[model samples]
Target: MLSPNTTLKQIEILGYLGTKFPNWIGDDSFNNIVDIKLSGSQHCSNLPPLGQLPSLKILHISSFDSVTTVGAEFYGNSSAKKKPFSSLEILIFKNCHYFEALSMSDGQCQELTYLSIYCCRSFVSFPNGGLIAPKLSDLNIYNCPELMWLPEKMTSLSSLKSLTIRSCPLIKAIPEGGLPISLSKLRINYHQLLRIKWNWQTLPNLKNTLSEEGFPTSLSSLSISGCPLLKKIYDTKDSENKEYWRKISHIPHVGGSSERQEEDSFLNMKQAMF
Candidate 1:
C-alpha cells in the first residue's frame, strides 16, 4: 500500500496489465497530480478517478484497447463530490479506438485552451453543449474518417484562434458563415470537401468601409490542401468573385513537369470558363 503522504505530481502508466487497477488509485494516489498519461494498457477498461486531481492541467490517454464506453460521469460521480479540472488547459486522446463519446457533466471548461483527438475511429462528433471548454483556443481533429462535420454550436468558441481538421473524408461543407470572427489561422487538409462557399456580406467588412479608418485585420491566413474534390471558392459579389478566382489561381503549385502541365491545363480551362 502506498502512503497517503506520497503526493505524486505527474504519473505515466504504460504497457499491458492483466489485473484490476488498485481502487486506492482513485482514493489516494492522485491528490497532487497535475499531469497524467496512460498508454498501451491492454487490459485497462476505465480511467483512474480523475476529478480528484484538482490541479491537473494536462491529461493524455492513448492505446487502452479494451475501453469501449466513455460515461457522462467519467470525471466523477455526484457521490464522490468531485468537480471538473478548473485548471485543466490541455487534453489529448490518441489511438483509443473503442472510445466513442465525451460527456461533461457541466456545460463548460473555463480554462481549457487546447483539445486534440487523433485517430479515434469510433468518435462521431464533439460532445453536445455540455462538452466544450469556454476558453478553448486551439482544436485539432485528425483521421476520424467517420466524422462528417463539426458541431453546429462551434461558433460559441468566442476565443478560438486556430482550427485544424485533417483526413476526415466525409466532411462536405463548412457551416455557412459559421467561422468565428476571432479566428486567426484556419487549415483544412484532405477532407472530402467539394466546395467552399462563404457569404462575404455575413462576414465583418473591415476593409471596404474602413479602408480609410484602418481597422485592424483579424484573419491573416487561410489554407486548404489535398482536397481533390474542391471545385470552387466564391464570394457574394461578382466583382469580388473575380478577385477570389485570381487569388486562387496565383497560389503556387509544387510539382514536377507533368504536374505543372496539368496545372497549366486546369488554369487555361478556368480562364476559358470564366
Candidate 2:
C-alpha cells in the first residue's frame, strides 16, 4: 500500500479533487495523519473508512449531498483489533442535508472532546443509546430539525462543560438522566417542548423551587430563548420574585431573549463557549 508522506499531518480534500476517494484513502496508509477535512464533495455517496487512521485527532465532513447514513463502513472493519476513532478529539459535520443517522460501535470515540453539527436539516438520530465520550467537554448542535432526543445517560458525562442546542425544534427535553454536574454553560433556543417546562413545572410562579435535577448548581451561565413560557418567569420584578431570583442568584450570568445583540455577536459568543 502506498503511504502518505511521512511528514504529512493534515490532509484536506476539497470538491475539486474528484467524485470519490481512491481505494487506499482511509486505510492504514494514513496512519500518521492527525487531521482530515472532507468538504464540498456533493457527488460522493459514501464516506471512506476513516476510523482506521490511528493518529487522527480531528475529522470534518461537510456539504456532501449524497451520504444518507454514516454507519459501520465509515468506522472500518470490526475485525481490526484497534478501537475505532480511539484518538479522535474533535468531530464536525455541517451542511449535509440528506444525512440521517450516525451509527457507531458502542463505546467508540473515547477521546473526543469537542463535537459540532450544523445545518444538517435531515439528520435524525445518534446511536441507540447515545454518544459515549467520557472526556467530551463541548457539544453544539444547530438547525437539525428532525432530531428527536439527546444522547442517553447524559448525566454520566462527568467531563461535559458546555452544551448548546438551537433550532432543533423536535428535541422535546433533556436526556432522561438530566445533564451532568460538570456542565458550566448551557443554551437552548427555538425548541418546541412547552410541556416539559424546562424541567421545572412549577418554576414560573413558585418561589425558591428550582429543580436540582434539571439545572445543575455548578452552572456559571444560562441562556434561553424562543420559549414563550420561560420568558414569563425571567420577566418578573426583583422584589416580587425574590425566591425565584434566589434560586438562580448564585449563577454569574443568566440571559433571556430580552437582551438584544447583533447576529454576529450572538454567533461569536456561542463559538467562544467551546
- Residue-wise C-alpha lDDT for candidate 1, range 105-194, written one tens digit per residue: 453356889988889887776666534666888988877887776765666777787887777777777664476655655556633323
- Weakest ten-residue segment in model 2 by summed lDDT: 200-209
In terms of lDDT, the best-performing candidate is 2
Over 19-43, each residue of candidate 2 has an lDDT whose tens digit, in order, gives 6677677777667889999989878
Scored by lDDT, model 2 comes in at 0.74
Give me the runs in candidate 1 sitting further than 4 Å from their true place.
2-5, 80-82, 175-177, 190-196, 199-219, 227-274
